[model samples]
Target: MTASLVSEPLDIASIRADFPILQKILPEGQPLVYLDNAATAQKPRAVIDKLVEVFEGYNANANRAAHTLAAMIDLELDAARSKVAALLNARSTDEVIFTPGTTAGLNMLAWGWARKFLKPGDELVISLMEHHANFVPWQQAALATGATLKFFPLTPDGRLDLDRLSETITPQTRLVALTAMSNVLGTINPIAAIAARVREVGAVFVVDGAQSVPHGPVDVQNPDIDFLVFSAHKIYGPTGVGVLYGKESRLRELEPSIFGGNMIRSVRVDGSEWADLPARFEAGTPAIAEAIALGTAIDYVQAIGLDRIAAHERMLTERAYAGLSEIDGLRILGPAVAHRGAILAFTVEGVHPRDLGELLDQQRGIAIRVGHHCAMPLHESLGLASSARASFAVYNTRDEADALVNGVARAVKSLRRKRS
Candidate 1:
């Protein structure tokens, strides 16, 4: 269903019941306020139960045996792939390849495609907002292949300057890799416009959707993306499972950099032919239980409805920005509330982020992320050594936003007094 079609507001209390950890009280006897969703989300009972079900029953290698358990595993594996394909609105199940995580998928692309296609004097365009997962692979690929790596400079407000798109991407550009949303800045990039420019220049467009996929709907066919990658753990699923959605033609052309038993059509003494589409890239025995449980996570989100989840988190972000703006020394890192995700990255004057994070956790039972958050270059570009981030999800409440504001204000007062 569309975003506009979400008729009723989400019942958060009922939703929180699905995740038992929400009821947890910290060792300090304070209730937990989990705001570190961008790092990883806590799993629901549905996902946990799904994992147990998969492991307890029919736990066997998929796609190679005639036994009952093996056949069951094969069917479950196919169903999991189909679920992931539906989540991304990919063209077909063949487009989705399972990897260990988003890092693995992007690394696979870097090794498989960049190594094969990129050459001397070619340009690889990226942005200052990319997480290291998307950044380092291309950077290393350029270093290895003698290609030049160009960056799209950020606007004054920390969003990608789309005006620089034309200047950055040229005919010589072989690939344009960017994050759909910045994990640090919480800025959502314009995918259609950027993808169009990349297409016009005949460059392969790859998206790091690790931050975006869990927040909202992603339609691959509509934007004509060559490849998009995201991790399951970020969306209330198990860790160690990721998805790489590549266009059918792109997957057909990409050489499998990983080699093992399940990926080959026939193995001879000489070189062997590879399997088709996804199996070509997914080498070895995959994460069967994790992948199956990931499908359950997808189902959990769908049942709650992505549009509803987005709206709920948007409300939470609005409350957070409004409350945090009232603090005297605090400065938010990204654009005004309208263009950001549920993340609020900020720094308080005279207060180190690590110190502030400790205060929030130890004294207030608030869980936030501190440090560069895996986007050190972005932080450096913004003239910040580090920052604290509080990201929201569907089950988060408005009261928790108030608690964060109160806790930070109190922490800042105590910290400044100690300095005095």
Candidate 2:
């Protein structure tokens, strides 16, 4: 396929070779067409090799021991944080904290920071299209703190309706938490504009970058984001590890919620002193090898370039949108192709999402996500119980998208015939 605007021509064949999983052959010799990137991306060989090296070469606990292995592991861990900070254009390495995933990071901020600042009658704003990861934490925080939770309504095309921003985000709103992009709808939110409004109200802005960061560039410093959360696995890194970026001042203001061995500077009988910025939040032993491997994954993506990756995915999205739009009863659930990312969530008239998904996988080895996509509120708002989703990534190809459309058409035809 030709490259998109502002992007260099990508040798997709060479790029696909880096991912070993892409070479898998199905039972009927069908090649796997992975379209579930919105959930978790497939890892590259470089990241895989790095993980093996970390485990075999230096398997030591970091920050506590004085041994050579420990020192080496600590350096690797620091390097990982530095790479992540650079990726997000964070002001300082100290501002970046490691967590299990985006869910853990959001939960940490909600329970630790929001609960601390939120009071009765205070308001917290979120969007209806948020994944449950970003939604439930704030909901529970509001319930616990007696703060009122407000939702920003969606436009007809699934974009956040920020026209009444002042009305939705009142002065009483202590915090505004929303996704940088919808995991279900693929709608990229205007974060900088939203941040400005949240700042106008003198409230904290927390961005769930679980979807956006992996697909495109995210400069936290430029956006004036107070807190940002994203997972490693979504960016072709290892699972079980994520990053949380907070402004240094903001991070220092809130106390750490999770307490344990490494998080404390001093543990006295009377009280305990917390460690500095990042260490304060990282309580237990971190995912040592996984974090280091995540650094390698970042390296892998940066080498290809984020702009090129995004451009490539956008092209694929355009192709997929055109193909899927032709199906007789398929109804897409997002903005136009120009406004959205590579995700396409839609419902077929007479087919259950699971049935469609199973047919795609079983018949053609086309792997697509089906169901609420962890955005039950978004589906409920859209008047859909569930929908099939095809999300693209850097490694996805034009032919794979066509295969998905063809499989869907065949499935719809057969399912309808059986009903008749």
Q: Which tens-of-lDDT digit does each residue in 27-94 have in candidate 2?
A: 87899999999999999999999999998999899889999999999999999999999999998899
Taking all chains together, each candidate's TM-score versus the true structure is: 0.98, 0.98
Give the Cα RMSD of candidate 2: 1.8
Q: Report residue 205 deviation for candidate 2 (angstroms).
A: 0.4
| Model 1 ranges off by over 4 Å | 2-7
Top of the candidates by lDDT: 1
Alpha-carbon lDDT of model 1: 0.92
Q: Rate the local accuracy (lDDT) of all candidates.
A: 0.92, 0.91
Clashing pairs for model 1 are: none
Error in Å for residue 107 of model 1: 0.3
Name the weakest run of 10 consecutive residues (lDDT summed) in model 2: 1-10
lDDT tens per residue, model 1, 170-201: 89999999999999899999899999999999
